[model samples]
Target: MKAVEYRLPKEFDKSFIVFTERGTYFPCPWHYHPEYEFVLVNRSTGRRMVGDHIGYFDEGDLVFMGPALPHVWVNDAAYVQGQAKEEASAVVVHFVEDFLGKNFLSLPELEPLKKVLDLSKRGLVITGKTKKEINRRINGMIGESGLRRLSSLFTIFDILTHSSEYQPLASPSYMQHTQGYYSDRFSKITDYILRNFQHEISLNEVASEANMATTTFCNFFKEHYRMTFVEYLNTIRIGHVCKLLADSDENVVNIAYECGFNNLANFNRQFKRLKGMSPSEYRKTLELQSA
Candidate 1:
């Protein structure tokens, strides 16, 4: 997506920011920034998009992203409609590579940290005990100041570099594509898909939106997304299905139709291809985890 670039609220006295974001909902649009970000979703449930990857996010969701990786956490319908019982909230930390000093990470002793930061180019979602410790330290940093706050950040990095409890969010193909500048045309196309994916979205329809012939648009999309339009559309539909499966008691057949799948078998096939589990199994897994 064509993400709007954002400037963090500057504080000349501080090298980094550690704060709690609390509100009825997270209001940031799909956006990017030059600073690396560490986010701990303390209270919320939503769809999170990082680069070309789409996944559901909930309370205790922790992700760290490299600079300029486009992302947004879109609250579920209940939060957007102000019907959610608990307000959205998160603990977020943002810092540039040189927040300590340009030469600091170049040090041999910091090689592991540098490696982790490179891996973060695709965004990393923390899990297991590592996530628990990082969340606690991030919350603690809210009250720290001066060198102490900075120290806490390094400590968090140390944990990340040494731990295996994380997974990359964006695909390598997507990351390779992001290295190039984004086109406004692709932005418009993705926006249209996101808005209208609940209905049948024809290749010709999106090609028209991009002001290109179907053949031309097909090549353009494949060049940027490394996938055919049908694949990308199915990806989006399946992502929404994941959120619905987790958040509602809706029947699988009905949910598939609502997400624009006309055939139950196709929905099941696509869901398993993308998510590695059947719809019922996916929901059951979440239930087991929560319990």
Candidate 2:
């Protein structure tokens, strides 16, 4: 279950890359790379996992991710099972942080852009007018060539830098803890946890996977993830529970056990703790959104 390191397609002659993906569903697993990424989910709805943040993402979803942040958009079960009539599609832009130049972002004129890039370390979801404009620019970029494409990219960045309609997805603590430890072992551990979180998991077993003693593993996980193993596990589980609550008609009790909570009370407590609402309330919120 180790996360595969994704090597994005790079053209030696180009400074950045833009592409569109259309599929039955997003096929990549939990993975990360060194390039910054801006993604527009043109069509589809699903669970999106970025760093330690988990939530629902839908059509018109716009997210900007900094270098080395692990993420994936897992289309809902209906999309995967071909129950949905439309295919999933997205436009993704990838570039290095210094794609302009090593010192360009350090210039006084570009200071605001630098701040936007820094905030993107936690992942940024653009909304309101900015998202609509950026989406238009992204579509335009798909048809541009040479300097026009780069111009559109910079324009999008300028809008994002000036707009106040962006939300940071992950906690600052989560970003701080995970920034410097981009090793194979860390990737493997995350991959294992993401794949197995729906079932019972034990620290001892995970520690064995990392070849560390239980105590050492616990400390290591806390140091890097800024949360105890169990807390992180529950965060992931509750995230899935939120998705099911929003997207399906399954009973809350069944969803609770299906998401790995052993009992109703614990599920309700953890759901409230993480989301600040009961599962039923959260579902009602979704209904309101749909209405």
| Candidate 1, 1-291: lDDT as tens digits | 246899878588998887788999998877889999999999989878776566889999999999988788888879878999999999999999898787978899888787678778879999999999999999999899998988898899889888989987864434433322335776688778878888988889999999999999999899988899999888778767766765688898999999899999999999888766798887775454333
Against the true structure, candidate 1 has what lDDT? Answer: 0.82
Q: Write down the RMSD of all candidates, one decimal each.
A: 11.2, 10.6
Q: Which residue segments of model 1 deviate by more than 4 Å?
A: 177-272, 275-291
All candidates' lDDT scores?
A: 0.82, 0.81
- Using alpha carbons, what is the TM-score of model 1? 0.63
Q: Write the per-residue lDDT of candidate 2 for residues 44-64, one digit (tens) a residue.
A: 999787765667899999999
Cα TM-score per model? 0.63, 0.64
Off by over 4 Å in 2: 177-271, 275-291
Q: How far does residue 20 in candidate 2 sit from its true spot (Å)?
A: 0.7
Q: What is the lDDT of residue 170 in candidate 2?
A: 64
